[model samples]
Target: MTSDDVRHRREAGHFVRWALAQKIARDLSFPAVRWNGPSQAMDDEARWATARRLLHDDTLKSEDR
Candidate 1:
């Protein structure tokens, strides 16, 4: 694989990890104004499901920035 491919993968991984953290933070309602809409509990498997789907989806690649 090329270096660019490796870099892209790394970026994607970072994105997934960041997303999971954000979800956890939000679920905890740390901030006073965060959306409290029918919040779902975040588990390892659920987070992994998000990452798995994200890694396979290129449609959102350009939206990260």
Candidate 2:
């Protein structure tokens, strides 16, 4: 493969990783505003727990991402 293809592949991989993370975060819970603060997302522990449950990695296309 060409260098351009390699670069695009890496970029797409990064996007998939991020998108999956966001998807998991959303699946975990909706952000809630604290009594006197801004809205907060699921805790780190929750996030990691979600990550641990994943069985495989998805290699998505740029459009899919």
Candidate 3:
């Protein structure tokens, strides 16, 4: 693989890890907050699922990039 490819992969991994950590922190900090109609619990579940999927996939995409 090219250097750029490796770098991108590394960055993607970092982003996924960061996202997973954030979800975990939020999950641990407090019960799902209900704001308006949507709840934090639903958001957390989606984030967790996305993070898991990204980690399993060979190629990672980061929105921050």
Best by lDDT, which number?
Answer: 1
* lDDT value for model 3: 0.55
Q: State the lDDT of candidate 3 residue by residue for 1-65, as single tens digits.
A: 23544545545555556766878434322223234854545677887887787777656566521
Question: Positional deviation of 20 in candidate 3, in angstroms?
Answer: 0.1
TM-score of each: 0.32, 0.27, 0.26
Q: Any runs in candidate 2 off by more than 4 Å, and if so which?
A: 1-7, 24-65
Q: Which stretch of 10 consecutive residues in model 3 shows the poorest summed lDDT?
A: 25-34
- Backbone collision count in every prediction? 0, 0, 0
**Candidate 2 collision pairs:** none
Top-scoring candidate (TM-score): 1
